[model samples]
Target: MKSTLKKLLPFAVVGVMSGATTVGALQYFNHDSNNTDQSYFTKASNVSFAGMNSAAVGDDFVKAAKTTVPAVVTIKNYQSRTSSRASEQDMLDFFFGDPFGGKGQQRQRQQQTPDNMPSGMGSGVIISPDGYIISNNHVVAGANKLEVVLSNKKSYIATLIGTDPNTDISLLKIEEKGLPYLNFANSDNIEVGQWVLAVGNPLGLNSTVTAGIVSAKGRGIGILGSQGKAANPIESFIQTDAAINPGNSGGALVNTNGDLIGINSAIQSTTGYYQGYGFAVPANLARKIVEDIKNFGIVQRGFLGVTSLDLSDDQLVAAYNKQKNTNIKAGSGIYVTGFGESSGAEDAGLKLGDVITKIDNIAITDFADLSMAVGSKRPGDKVQVTYSRNGKDATTTVTLRDQKGGTATRTKADLSVTEKIGAEFQSIDDKTKAYYGVNSGAVAKNVMEGSEMAKAGIVDGYIITEINGKPVNSQKDVENLLNKFSGTVQIKYLDDYGRGYQRGFKMP
Candidate 1:
């Protein structure tokens, strides 16, 4: 009886062990990381995973995307691109020899083949409900016609209102109402590493949204003056890495709340594609330009009227110190080299030797910083200027003046054009004339589309010194002379490179 009991006990113990193993296997198989679902080990074990670091929850940009995507748009620019140019023919003659021989030459001069249609595309941000859109100047600069398409697939013909090349911003209107627009955010409040979204028609893909963080602030890429678009340009770009491509120009870069912080302008890449770096014009400055264009028909720029030298420029520092008996070098902020005629600097009692330390409360770290601060000001605005004279800090209030050195606003409207001259002009300013060593000339500001200037291969930044071998001083002089003169008219002009050239255009 004792032997039989022992055998039964061994079998019972084995059965109990088998049952425990099966339960453990089931628990391991159904293991879940959710707090609600836990195994015996997870509940009973004293082990902790708290020492392991976990990422903080990030913002879900869904709401921002929904709010912004509707306001962003695609801008299509259509230009009547005449492929047949005299220079192209000349280049053909030089490289491959004229295909039509000398026969094509006479016809090419007398008649232009205006069939090939050239077009460009970019993005834009609708700022107002009544159809005011902000975009990069290069996007719609020479477009004969502009077409705007919304995210909802609605299309409208956009009118070219005005452009400010200095800031690389252009204002357009679509004559439509009830448009969803994005409000401007305080760009100064945007911090690096803050979440940002770029919404636009990148690569012609409509309503594309990309997310990133603000990589930098107050970045100057120097695309303005060098491009022959503007003389004194201001570029304090908010740099980001939200994958801005070819068609992303003029798109909206918004904060997490979907507020427009900037208008995407340019990309810094050698391959012409997004290699991480993207730039945008600050919303504050852009808004100012839009209001100026809407009210004044042109940007009312405030001129400090001084040829200031950036201390960050090593060559400029060397030249200045050598030319003038003084110890000047980098990190001196901005030093006044000379004064303009009744300029803001002169009015504020700023001297040539003064080193600008700050503007208002913002520090002037460099020229780009100074440009950003002053570039946002209007002609009549008063700003508190801070400087250092002989290493002593000083402050003064300056009444900003226009480029013409006065408070009176300069209007570009109502200037009637006779015939299709295809360009706008102004008598070269004294500063510009002295720089180019030219006595009298009219500087071509806007070279219009399908005009005689465009046909004659004249471009912006060309200084027209003489017409038919006679000096033309102002816009009136140009119109008066062109009105009276007939047949082939020879225009002597100085290119931005200071090289002189002659171009002939026939007018009946």
Candidate 2:
């Protein structure tokens, strides 16, 4: 279990589960697709009658299940994990009193070694017959190799195309044609009470389908924030009660019509299993990410350049009210707290106290709504923003910008790995180990030409053995540890004589 799942949901699974963590490195399963044994499924919302017979909301979900199962896939991820990295549960325990919230009694669990390879499973949807698949980023985040198993038991090694951690969406490719796939549905038109099916391989069971309705839309569950990032993570989930489990990440969440509407992303649970709530990345946002990855090799996000928070939370709204000395209603609208230095808010006549109510024709009830609306567009895009100023409605046509406040289309080259990490490290060699008396470590191969590492006076051959307090045995270990870690870090290393040295490094 190298890179043991860094963030255990404490029953708060980010819609990604670990049902396949023990499936072994080279293990593969082929199962019969025709399982017709019916046994009172607890959740299926009724299928709607189109041109056929009349239907009710409690009708059988056979139609939606049958249509979606074929397009959903089980993905096996194989990645080298770090041996000494901490589990997400441990981190949560460090921050919160009870990892699974303050509910009931805390149960002790056995610990396992993390040096083993990561063998996790998740679900994905086939969007194109030519093998363009969409899934959550956490599903294939660190996978050195990815294997996608079709419902027909046919498996293909999937190629990683691009990933957006902020949105938890990734695009994958495989060489296949005329495969059973699900077309993207208009998620915006999906109502809150409409019937939907969650088709995926939960608990490693092939092609399981559960039924439920859209419980809520534009939900921000704080899962992405737990991973740590800058400028707030964009999340607008389609919440449902469709029984999402550990292995259901990246699965197809479809309407009664069997069209794809969302990708199951996280679950709101108590013990890391489904507990009447699950969340999905809306199809519109996922589709946009897929299109951007396919076209630009990077996600080109549009920015409104405004700092705002959702007024849906009672405490949040109360705080804003107290701070601003005004009575703002909760459960509706986004209260603009400030403007981004490079934002169009000021230029577009947006004030600090303005409350955003809508973007274009779409109603924005909270931050999730605003984020999803603006995030789906690209830099240089224009949108009509509607807001309230002292009970008076105001509208402005504003042009969005990138983080750099420019309208340039971003490519993969815009932010290279070197620019991200600041320094390049190499694995410790046998001779170096003998002289250094260290079991494993990474040698600073070369600091970036104008990187923070260079500014910090770090040089080549500086063997980095630890990041913060976690041991780093190799370059991959370093990368895995640094992925979601923001702010400042303590880099501990060994000199040529193996003498220890620690330095402060900031993640830029």
Which whole-number lDDT from 0 to 100 does residue 160 have in model 2? Answer: 88
Model 1 error, position 296 (Å): 0.9
Per-model TM against the reference: 0.71, 0.67
Compared with the true structure, the alpha-carbon lDDT of candidate 2 equals 0.72
What's the lDDT for all of these models? 0.75, 0.72
Per-residue lDDT tens digits for candidate 1, residues 13-83, read 74466447434633553343121101101111222221211112124577789899999988877754334
Instruction: For candidate 2, write residues 1-508 as lDDT tens digits.
Output: 5334443322224122322332321133214211111110122233221121112433346777778898899887775432222233333443243446643122222233132333677889999989999998777755668888999999899998977778888889999999989999989899987878898887667888777778888888777765542124788899887767677889999988888899988876543455577889999889999999999877898999988767878898888789979887786888888887788877999998788899997898877888899999999999999999989999999999987798778775565444365567777677877776666678876454224564343566678766777877776787778776778877766655455654466775
Q: Pick the candidate with the highest TM-score.
A: 1
For candidate 2, the per-residue lDDT at 455 reads 39
